[model samples]
Target chain A: MASTIAEKIFASHLRDTPTPGDAVLDIDVVMCHEITTPIAITDLMEKGMDRVFDPDKIKAVIDHVTPSKDSKTATQAKILRDWARRHNIKDFFDVGNNGVCHALFPEKGFIRPGYTVIMGDSHTCTHGAFGAFAAGIGTTDLEVGILKGVCAFKEPVTMRVDITGTLPVGVYAKDVILHIIKKITVNGATNKVMEFAGPIVDRMSMESRMTLCNMAIEAGGTCGICMPDRTTAEYLWPFIDDKYESVDDAVKDFKQWHSDPDAHYDSTITIDVSDLVPQATFGFKPDEVKDITDIEGENVDQIYIGSCTNGRIEDLRAAAKVLKGRKISRNVRGILSPATPSIFNQALEEGIIKIFMDAGFCVTNPTCGACLGMSTGVLAEGEVCASTTNRNFNGRMGKGGMVHLMSPLSAAAASIAGHITDPRKYLQ
Target chain B: MKQFGGPAIFLDRNDINTDEIIPAKYLTENSKTALKPFILEDLHLEGFDPQSDELKNAGVIVTRANFGCGSSREHAVWVFEVNDINVVIAESFARIFRQNMFNCGMLAVELPKEDIDIILSMGNVDIDIDVTNGVITAKGAGEKTFNFTLNDFARELIQAGGWLAYADKKY
Candidate 1:
């Protein structure tokens, strides 16, 4: 049978021919963050194994509760730092040095095409934008990877999602994904790998592709991956090591990282986004997304424009375009957090930060921040927010606080209007 | 590990995500004890406090589809373990949540929808798990037997007291 991208990647790491079942595969990279790493370390220590299998393959970052919100979290970060240093792990990124693990992993070039990556983070699938097969594992499974350098998996069936037609003006990649999730339902793709393809995907920027792959878990998918193309290669060129003769050479090297033309898939879903509108979630689940026009005048007390989902420079630029020269509603509080320090620096250089600051927005440091309800900008009881973060499960932002997920454009527009409003007018 | 029986608590809702199982606020604290009070606290199930005696005493939890759907936090599973919830029989489970259960040496069985409904109807009845035979038996009025599925790999991991113990023995 022709191999899907996931099958091709998994088979490359094993000596035996790949079958559609459980098998232990070697991992190219193992990533973890503050929230999950300490637990894995504790498990390793409890097992009386003090050393990691390979420090080189492990990437640890303090992102979730960075700057140490409280004494408890500070102690947890201390334990991770101590453990990484004791093991001489070279890829450890301390607070302020690293942003979110998912964004930083790609920004630092730790993820490459056709690699099998595992992390103790559900959004680990975000790395799949580079044409890699990545998925999240629990802390104990991460402990197993740390000790054995390999993790077991029950081969997931592939669900081919093909997007056609150019996205309409004012609609972003976030809308496309939210639309797909709404169609697929929250549990539609459970235990499956979603292989995104077609004309629209072929034309999407790297950041947009990352946005799509990042939320695959929201629909209960194990992972979502796109085959690497020239666009992917171009986005990765700058991050490639100096060993490559040129960007063209780097692209040439990634030629082997794609699914076969005849790759087999369990199911196929096709969506045309030519008439797509900006989408926003009206309820707790991402699948509750509706077109921006359908949700006009829904009031909100806050608006957030960042997270691993929509915190890229492109997302910032989109929100900046909407917020430029416009004052936000006095009744609303707005925050714009970049996904990584690199993106934050780029935004500053481009004056995106100036636009946000002049618009009465609180431009915070890059961290999971308010997305996980951990630190700064957490929602208060009875408050409603229009946000660009991925999950909107009840109390995701804070106790009794509600969130409506949307694209950065829509979120910024909502901040201006103090309600969930369409961004098309602002875009025009 | 063969036959074990305990009182079962039925949660009829579907898509009971990890956020509902254990919210992100409680995730900052690593202690299993600190997590007990918050287990299923977000569910707002009428007359059921996660800390109340009624829920604290139940050893098995029966629920509908997609139990533990969001976030890869093992704390969702840890909350159950700390609260003495040894087994969770759901119609389906999110992949990561299911694996976390096995990693903690807790049993997460996927039963047919009809069987889950039958199990729920037998409220407060003792449900016995037969790991070796892959059977679930309810010891109450109209005692019923239902078959469940467990791969050998997961069973072995549970037998060895979770992934940590299994890894120690392997590596």
Candidate 2:
């Protein structure tokens, strides 16, 4: 019988029923924030379910309102901390040691390719960057995972997004994703697993790959994944046990991208970066976008180049290099947050941190930070922000604050201009 | 189940996401009953309110197109059920919300998109869905026929009022 890369990995972990994708496969990793855990634990207790299926498989992080601003959100954070201990949940990544759950979990090795992971955030597809099948769920679903150690999911139609050829000199992975969203529009992937394959994808770094999969859900997909390869194993080797080897074996064994040749998809979208340049989202919706050079006089009040979308060390460096010899405009508050502690350390070693701080930008510790309205660097009411995070909903970052999503390069340029400006105009 | 008036106050539309049905914050309740106040809250906080004159007179709703489009919050259905809205009429529904509503006794009524607009535009006008003839009769709106089709299980569940009631009788 033939199986997709995700099905093969899920089949390996099934101990009881091996009925393909319909069966509830065992979960290798689980994550819950403070907000959801309080209720999930309550449900498990009412059902007389004692002891989590495996506390070690879960990570409870205080990301939603980290650095809890006032006494109210702080009170909620404390409840999360107490519940973490009561449930004996392990991997409770704390303040200063954590960023967004999506970015930090994979960086720390809880996720490996060819594995099935379930978390409480829809963007859990972020784990797919490592070649794993991860999706988000609700509180009740998390409760089921905590007790049964499995999640019920159907096999999604496989979509092979073949992106080959070279990207223009100034373009980065962010531009590639924005280009895909534009062609497909929103709700394009309804219920499918998008496997990004091709020469360009293989050459992209793990951090860049994560950024792509992270936005897959915006198109209404179940999840998005890439095939595990040599780079996949290298990234996992440090934090995971050496005994748990060959992380990419299943993906490579099956040649991950082969789609049954006859396998059909409900939809398809191709992106050719031959003439692409730095891009940004112009309006409230992600698909409402523009090339950096297209718009004039769009004022930017804040510039943030961080979050699960573009919060890697490379993303920081790309922006920091632009901010090197200059300062952030007086009225603008430029935020440079690395996605993980390890990435933060790497930036420090590479002098990226010095460049960012010397530019008069505020260097925040790792966190999702206002990316999903979780509150780390929220703009005041009516403030206009040019950010590298996903989503710019009406009140996503505070009441009435206008959000403009952009690539890291564009955000840095906007920081220098104190308004939404193009990077090509500022670059050497 | 949040209120006695609705097995579910049906709405029209398919692909109704959790984001459109309810704002994201209410999904974490340990008790599913807490979700009763948020249905259709996304369209207008007032429309889903029990006190809203437009909705108070009608006990159920049905819609066309993607009924609930974003987020998988079960609260979306709960809010509708709480507002006394019962029997969702739509051509299709989001996969997650449909499954959740079925588990809670919210009958998901499937029909074509054109039929749904007839029912919605004629608000407060109750229609008798002739399942056999695949027709809906909207009072003065003159034979605003519809095609009400349902899987055997969903049909049985709605007939029984909800899952708990269905299970109580069948199991």
Q: Best DockQ goes to which candidate?
A: 1
lDDT (Cα, tens digit) per residue for candidate 1, span B43-84 = 735565666776878888888888889899999999888887
Among incorrect, acceptable, medium and high, the docking class of model 2 is incorrect
**Cα lDDT tens digits for candidate 2, B3-102:** 2222113344334455546554444344556766555444522234534565555555656654554455556666766666655666666455565566
C-alpha lDDT of all candidate models, in order: 0.86, 0.68
Alpha-carbon runs more than 4 Å astray in model 1: A15-20, A241-244, B44-48
Candidate 2: residue A360 Cα off by (Å): 3.1
Instruction: Mark the regions of model 2 whose C-alpha exceeds 4 Å error after superposition.
Output: A10-23, A70-72, A244-268, B1-52, B55-64, B70-111, B126-171
Chain B alone, candidate 2, TM-score of 0.68
The residue pairs found clashing in candidate 1 are none
Interface DockQ of each model: 0.64, 0.21
